[model samples]
Target: MTGRPPKRQRIEPRFHDGESGSLDMRLTAEDRPAAGQRPNAPRKAKPANRQNASSGSRSGPARRKSAKSRRGKGGRKRRGGNSRLLRFVKRGAYWSAVLGIWGIVVVAGVLGYYAAHLPPTSEWAVPKRPPNIRIVSASGHLIANRGDTGGEAVRLEQLPHYLPEAVMAIEDRRFRSHFGIDPIGLARAVFVNASSGRLVQGGSTLTQQLAKNLFLEPDRTFSRKMQEVVLSLWLEQKFSKDEILEMYLNRVYLGAGAYGVDAAARRYFGKSARLVTLNEAAILAGLLKAPSRYAPTNNPKLSEERAQTVLLAMHDAGYIDDDQVKVALAETATIVANRQTSSENYVADWVMELLPGYVGSIDTDVIVDTTIDLDLQHAAERSLRTALASEGGKLAVSQGAVVTLDGSGAVKALIGGANYARSQYNRAIHARRQPGSAFKPFVYLAAVEQGLTPETIRVDEPVRIGNWAPQNYTRKYRGPVTLTEALSLSLNTVAARLAQEVGPARVIDTAQRLGISSPLQKNASIALGTSEVTPLEIAAAFVPFSNGGYGVVPHVIRSIRTMKGKLLYSRKGDGPGRVIDPYSLGAMNRMMAETLSTGTGRAAELEGRPAAGKTGTSQDFRDGWFIGYTGQLTTAVWIGNDDNSPTKRATGGSLPARIWKDVMVAGHDGLPVSALPGIYEAPVQVAEPAGSGLVPPGRIGDDPGRPILPEPGKGRGPLNLLQRIFGG
Candidate 1:
């Protein structure tokens, strides 16, 4: 083509109407632009005819359609993008609604599950509080309270204003404002507990606490919490604010077996709720958090600290001014020493044991009038504690018990242990231990009933029975001694010999008849006090020796009645009947009397009055006992180790005799000196003034009707001696 090629000519096409009435145009090569060159503009041409113009309009429609297609394509892209976003938003909304419904269902299901375990709303009601047992001494002084509700319910108005105020201030500040639930407090507690990873605070209101104590078991669980919330709401709706507070104060448990604020006040302060002071009220309020932990009797210093916290709370709540808080802080509550650790609780415990038998199923508040003389109880406890404090460590003795009874078998004083707080085991009424030679009285009484006189001779020598040989305490033999002398010296062999002479069965019968209810083994060892017996029974058994041989059943509760004065049980005046004959009673008294006068029990001898008793030392000095009595009272003292370990040679004549003498001295204070029953002999000398009505010492007899000794061969001794001395 480059070798001298001919040049190409340009051609322009013109529009024309074809036979089909369509417009058309044509262009020659001349209209096309050369490579890399701009094309020349086409010149406008006029329509050839009207038909041609109309045909030209068809081309305009084709161009417009092409432009419309381009615009539609862009709009389609925009529409597609918008539709995708709309679809995404719609899908999200649908799923959100589904999840919301499921969440509501789950919460409702959880709530329903917990609600199903609760009782029906119609059946829900506040449970009745358990009845209380109030025990008072013979003088009508409250000794203790025994029951689920330790004391009777106290009205809100009956208590001091500060008492309830302090409780609300520390326990629930918004108790009167909230509807049983403090959402603010609960949220704060939750946040704190979660942040600290431990539970250090509680969000329960006073009504909630009452609900838990009244109806719910002490369990920690989500279910229990839910139930508590439900019950709290119910309680709030049913009871007034004052009523709820009163019920909470009365139903909440305090320490030391106290149930209500009244009981706690009486238990720790020895006063009623109405008499509690501001300091005392603060202390009581403090115990609501942890009763045992902050009990004044348990930890006084810690309790005071807790009370200080309560006082501050009270001040902040505007219940008390700064001066009042200062006064409260300065004047700490004085906890009554006796109420917390008194020996009266021992008597109260005994009364409680006998309560159910007197009135079965205690369903109401009852008052028990017990025979415990507060004075004598104080004396007994004082003497026992004094003795133990002085000689407990020296003698290696750790515990002791005492029991005292009047001629009519009324328990005047009873000390179960050295410290009742340390041990509640009532040794006086429950513990059974060998009485050693104390049992010899039963053996001698049996002998006397079989015609053996106090002057009767019995050789004190080593004796054996069925491979068992009994030796005297002194391990020496007295060739011949009277029955009185043998018993006064507490000769073990002689007692064994007598048991053999008069069958052991007879001795047991005599013991049982005299109020020794414990079982006795039918063997020779029984005569030497090998059998175990409680101090109560032993003291009761000796009552006849001082009261004309009339048997007695040891009783502490004299009468029981409801709080409204409805009598439930009243002790009758009838005696336990005669258990020993005149001759036997006289003979036994004569022998036992010599023990206090010049024998092992000499330490227990009274100064201005005649006393009779026996001394007993168990094997290896494991137990030391002195059971003695005067014309006024009979008391038993036992000192030993709780572990049954031997002492440092402590004998009945030492600690036991001294404690018995001290107790007797206090018991017989201000009373006229009198002779023992069946003993018409006067005292050696009149220790008091002549106008004191004291029988002069060395007098032959006071009563002119004293019986005279009968002939040696008489059928039985004269009954006049006993009849005159005992007023039989």
Candidate 2:
């Protein structure tokens, strides 16, 4: 085929110009010349002329110059314009990389510096929590968790899944996947904050929050943040994700005097965390941002609103469904009432006071088994609060206290004040005030011991001794009344005359035998409760009359045990053995019982049970006290001002007796109604002799400022030293 084509060799030509010559073009590899031969090639010879040569040699440079000129007019302008933009982009990239590197370096430097300041990793340890005093009532119900933490550490699995889930959803959603820190979250936070021009969210994870709460100081500085990061990494390395979450849940502060979720749950809802509902979990989880502000006890509306936000977040995190969110949103969290919440706190504090004696120094956690009856405690608190609320302003009673004790001297219930949160000073045990007429029992007991029967007649008329002349509270004295009537009427003059007859020493001895732990004055006025005494002392002193004249020592904590179930202390025996004389006890009980049945403390009479008590109004009504008892319990109530200001004639029969009656009624609910332990004497209403007109003795002294005895006693008054030795 090639030889045949070669024979024809037909040519195709093309013309460039109108006048022109033809030019041959190679169309394929077959038209190219052979390698060794010059065949099939055409060349033009050079012309020999200086001007033409110069023009020909200059053509390339001239064309290039012409193209450069054209480029300067258009292409160069385009290229230069693009060059600035490229240079800008390149410079931006360079500086961005440089700044990024510097930023990393600075952050690394900060982290290193803060980490250097931290304690050695080998020495790092979770410090032991402060000693927690777990106080429980007589029925073994948790009265109050007292200490810095206010609760015990709970395990991770012990809490409900919704609890930690709520925490993670609202606090740190990526808690599972993130390695201590989440850069994506941080970047998003920065972006959102920058775009909104406000910090809407924090970049810290739950681990970081836990780290700050557990290990680091709460300071919002770069150093603090860096330390938090380092601690968070340490925590991640030391513990699992669940362990971290558990620590956080157990240690995080939840306000309302609650240090952990357990305490908070109990404080707000009166339930354990395991029993907390989803709504409660959300509310508790919402407290992490601001515990006080979101506390349900503080503001339920705000707490519920924050909880709604938390529920929405949980739904968005896919932890809860729409129905659940809706249900949670609709649910309302009811905080525990303040009175009920802190009722046990007073008992807990009372128990704590006795904890040191039982367990010595509280180096380890101890459980104090207190004698507080929570129900009775609540009753006492409610009674006191209700009494104060209804009559406090009218009576000028700014504060009040109630103490209820069983016959065995066990403090069944105690309320220190109207509100424990407002005042912690336990007036029931610590407040010492004069017990006006309430102290007359000792005087009557002394008189009965000295052979003065309840029918012993005493003239109530005034008698002056040296400088003092005591007047009746009513300013009108009943003439020639029996000892029983004089005491029932709380006649000051009769009480003074009896004190003088028995001698103040015997009266002091009688009070000490019964359980007055306070100092009693040896002066004649001692018969009128001129000495300061605590409500607890008064209540305890009345116990002997209820318990057939057996003395009692008031004790709250019954036993104490360590967290490991080792018994630290236990009360072995009963109170000081039989301090009161049986005869005197019977006579005193009979006389004092008459006071409640038909006297100043008549308002304290129970509907079904016979009661015995005394009404005491301190000088100028500074304090109103009702120390009363039934067969089962003896309670004392004090109503007064913390500032020692006089009340609006508040007598023991008004507020104090009412409170005592309420408490005793509630305390004796199930117990059988029994008569008070004593001898009962029938009322002896004597007919006044028509011709016997009782006249008061003449005033002897220029100044009648001192109180006097109506008749002389057989022996001298008991020494104050001996009274002190035998009494309290």
Candidate 3:
């Protein structure tokens, strides 16, 4: 067969370009050459394909499928990531909800635990404040306040506007808006403390502080804090903002034993809260943070600085404008000088001790009219403090006490110590120390009551009783001295001999009769003033000598009355009358007068006035004393170490006498000077020739000068004879 196959015939369908599109002129499969054969030759059968093929092998659809597969993979990958993220978020939310629920439960349980310890809601109420004791001086000037609340509670309306404003400004500016607890303040405090790495700010609102002060213990534990919070909420719910502020002002404890704004105002400024100025109010408010640290009486400069801070806070809080702040800064609060350490409080304390005895239990505020003269009290305090401050170190004397009284036994001024703030031991009224030679008056009085005169003679030589021998302070004996001279010079030997002969029991009786309540030892040493007694008692005992033999009980509270003016107590009369007879009184007064005029107490002599006092120095100079009195006033001054250590030769003739003189001078200012009772000119003694065997008309001398006579049962010897003559 020929290789060439059939010839191809071309047929074209003619159509105009405009009429119809050109038809296809290519060869059709039916008219074309057969496959697997030469061109135009006959067709052959197809062999079986080895390669596997399916619908997936189609290129057109496979390309499309591959692209679709790639797109699907990317979509699946994105969906898987989204699914993981969604699961993570769901788990986190679920755990967060669980934790949140547990946290709320724990907080609720903690709050419940603290709240359970509290009183029943219906029973919650402000506790009644302790009754106040307002002590006023004899001249009706406020001396001090004595009570749980140092001063009376003042109403909010009574206080100056700036006082509460200053407190609110510095303590809690959001006081009006906040609901008991201040979350914003707490958060701010936390942030500040955390950032500073220390506690510089407190989150306590005013309500919180009041709550803590009123109901909660002053502890810094978390439990206490929670309790404070609960109480604060309760307080806010129970009272209005103004009421809470008022309670805070009236209950918050300031320093120096003062509680409440009224007390603080009076304590620091010596004025009522109603009268406090802006600067003073700021100072009072400044004390809230640390009362002692910023107390005006303690550190005035620091207190002023703190007050300045308060002023600034007030200015910032819009309570005071810039002009007002400037004015306040310029007019820094003038703190009452020495208010905390004032000797007036000593008198107030003494009155308080006697309050219950007079008025029974103190359930209501009482006004105690004290015999204290504020001016004289200040004078005494200044004198004692000045002496101690200037010479205490040099003399090795740390403390001193002074007590002044009128002849009627009214305590005009009393200082218990050099600084009452440093020590509250009322040395004037409580401390029983050896009066030393100050007790000699009682001995002499006893001898006088037994018919001895001031002119009676006694030898100032060493005397012994048992094993105890009393020696003079100078350790020198002055022989053949009169009773007046012996008492004036405070000769220990003469006193000892007299007490031995007449019996110390007589001396005890004399002392007790003259208002000395302290127990006395019945011994010869007691004549040398070895017995212990309070300054108050010693001064009281000496009152009879100044007031013409009328005994006095040293009293500070002149009268006591409630705030409503109901009289509870009033000192009725002068005293237990005539404890000392005229004979003994005249003799003792003359002898003690010679002491101030010519003896050791000459330093305490009051000019142009007849004053009598005795000088006393305890053994080793541990205590120095000057107990003296004018016709109008009697004062006792004692200087010593509280620990009973010896001083640096501090004698009664020195610091104690100086303090006594200063106090007496101040006490007698503007008063008529009069001679002491029973003080008169001594008749001039005609000089007796030396070695004369005859005794002078009124003199009882040693042997040969006087006859050696004895009483019945007593031996007829010089010693017994002399004892009879001198001891009587």
Best by lDDT: 1
In the range 230-274, model 1's lDDT, one tens digit per residue, is: 788889989899999988888888888788998888889888888
On residues 178-291, what C-alpha lDDT tens digit does candidate 3 reach at each position? 999888999999999999999999999999898888887787899999888888888888899889999899889898888998888888888889999999999999999999
lDDT winner, 1 or 2 = 1
Shift in Å, residue 573, candidate 3: 4.5
Rank candidates, TM-score, best first.
Answer: 2, 1, 3
Give the residue spans of candidate 2 off by over 4 A: 1-110, 297-302, 339-342, 361-366, 562-564, 680-728
Q: Which portions of model 3 miss their true places by more than 4 Å?
A: 1-117, 170-205, 218-237, 253-258, 266-270, 286-326, 335-338, 363-365, 386-396, 459-481, 564-566, 643-651, 679-728
Ranking by lDDT: 1, 3, 2
Predicted structure 3, TM vs. truth: 0.71
> Could you give candidate 2's per-residue lDDT for residues 612-670 as a string of tens digits?
88999888999998998877889999999999999999998889988989898889888
Candidate 1's TM-score: 0.74
Question: What C-alpha lDDT values do all the predictions have?
Answer: 0.82, 0.79, 0.81
Prediction RMSDs, each to the true structure: 15.2, 11.8, 15.9
In the predicted model 1, the residue pairs found to clash are 10-30, 683-697, 684-697, 685-697
Between 2 and 3, whose lDDT is larger? Answer: 3
What TM-score against the true fold does each predicted structure earn? 0.74, 0.77, 0.71
Better of 1 and 2 by TM-score: 2
Residue 257, candidate 3: how far off, in angstroms? 5.2
